[model samples]
Target: MDSSSLLKEYPLNPVVWDEMCVQNEVRAPYHKVYEFLKQISTEDLTRKEEMARRLFMNQGITFTVYSSGEGIEKIFPFDVIPRIITAAEWDFIERGIKQRLKALNLFLKDIYHNQFILKDGVVPIEMIYSCPHFLREMHQLNVPHDIYVHIAGIDIIRDADGEFYVLEDNLRTPSGVSYMLENREITKRIFPDLLPQNNVRTVMQYPQLLYKNNPNGLLGVAGLMSAYRKGNVAIVNAPGNGVADDKAVYIHVPAMIKYYLNEEPILKNVPTYQLNNPDEQAYVFENMARMVIKKTNESGGYGMLIGSAATEKEMEDFKVAITANPREFIAQPIISLSSAPCYLNGKLQPRRIDLRPFALCGPDGIEIVPGGLTRVALREGSLVVNSSQGGGSKDTWILSK
Candidate 1:
């Protein structure tokens, strides 16, 4: 069988965009990859994927997933197929994300300083004040180079329309670039022939993109913040940025961009409803089965309720929780996140996935490593892609054109 026939054997979800092959047509950026894979045997391909998993585990590239009372450290799942983005597509994504982050950084500074946006009514003042990550102590404090968002993991997801939307902003200590770099390394070993002869545009800035393993978690947050304030060391993501990414605060980011940059957002936010609004709350509560509810401050895919997957008891419990503290929650129509082919269970399977590109805002400016982490929902038909939520990582490739 040819490449087309082999790949088409796996059914593509009708509602999601396939990153590699679309309706029997290989996308331009993935054309080379399709040809390359055509010559490889399925058994050999399976072997390589298994090898990749072992390599990740041996390198200690893992995240702990807790269940009941146990913390289990498992090697993050790796998909051998590269998710390719064309040069033009990447240019749009790169520019749009940099713009969004700039707007968010300005918003953070403004919120911490004069509260201009709030005073102007571009964003509700109560939204900021109610945010759990909003820190009053950072008011008037200066971040080195005036860049509050040193590192950001801006999650991008494609809906059924194949348009990318900024799913969420990871402003405070965004993890996963480690996996990005690791994925590239493993790819190097797995596809040495293709990468060497052709200089595929990969995440080349390794030194700057990778984050130090934070063994201490929040215990280190205080020390890092103090040193940051003192100018002793510039933290990658300046402290107190969590407020900007708070789910409730995220909905207003486009407004922040408009207010601060005076430019329309290049990337649109997923339509979100702040539970604090009585009308929005009523709508969300009435349509609980069609919405995905999340706590404004939650991360690592925690504190989320997938309406389609939730049990009735869980919905009742979550509805009561949201009702009890409406300001703490936000809801969005469950988006059909794009899918990618993953080598799992000894076969190529379609898995829901999202893109998280890491942005480094240094003294110079924002420099994004070509492709970031492509997190996959390892389970069948799942949307949650955090590694902690049984998700996996894939090497993302930005074609050289």
Candidate 2:
């Protein structure tokens, strides 16, 4: 391919891991996709992108954004190129998520009952007591099957060294599975032959997999608490799921895995600092610009500050907020997320991306659909990948081989 080809315009940064390329050579997993793109004209690729948008609109594949109590509906943005993953990589991710979920479920059961981890000082008692999501009412309450997290969306990102790290665990009513399914359908409409040629595994079975564990007749929406107490209705994400959702509690997941399962973590967590600690707070304050500060109990990309992207005034204001309620915040050094080629404005550009593989924990065991929602930071040099933050998504292809 010449320098003007779609593949050539994508500039690889030495510090950022490129998913499809390494030093101008295409990676093995993305070799087919890279060759296919080289044969397509830029105009043809642009048309495919446009076709994806139209299909999304027609199919009502969208999410609503709420601002100032008003909800604004917008079509979910999708990139034309699909993100591809090798079989080995998918196996690694699948095993890691299942192991993490097992530990988290065990932690929830222990936290609300025996408090063994707390007594053993694996996790602090004060941290649990101060967390808003720690439900006192759930203490000692029995749940069916001992499964606290049924559906989990684990946010994972590849760092500069191309190593996968768990960003956070979303145990409370995790969304975006629909987006994962829809992205695949859109890709089928846009690139009909590519999927079969690549031997990409199917994510179409996700809905059926979920139905396999569906609750048997539902009680009336009213008196849910009463029904739940009597075991008449089992919640999908059992009550007190938010306890695991707390970012403060997230700092202890690796330890939880070892404590409950007696195994070291298969997936590592991003190095997180607890702002409630005096020494850690002092360190974060001094190097604020190199970190990303987040509210412990908040989600949807809200209540966060990317210190590197913040203005001086914004950083100062965030510091004041962190000081006032140190327990509500945690900080991590900004990760240089992996990037993939994306077709933008008739040119291929590199965009940062993350993967959120949906894991379904059922009575039988955990089943992770091979492919996932590959969320991309569409804007140039942007790091945030939440849809609410101007992010787009592309279909993820998990090769069968």
Please report the TM-score between candidate 1 and the true structure. 0.93
Segments of candidate 2 deviating more than 4 angstroms: 1-4, 217-220
Q: What is the lDDT of residue 223 in candidate 2?
A: 85
Candidate 1 local lDDT, residue 381:
80
CA deviation > 4 Å runs, candidate 1: 1-4, 196-199, 208-232
Worst 10 residues of 1 by lDDT: 210-219
Q: What's the lDDT for residue 80 in model 1?
A: 92
lDDT string, candidate 2, 296-364, tens digits: 998878999998999999999989999999999999999999999888887778999999999988889
Error of 1 at 218 (Å): 15
The candidate that wins on lDDT is: 2
Name the weakest run of 10 consecutive residues (lDDT summed) in model 2. 1-10
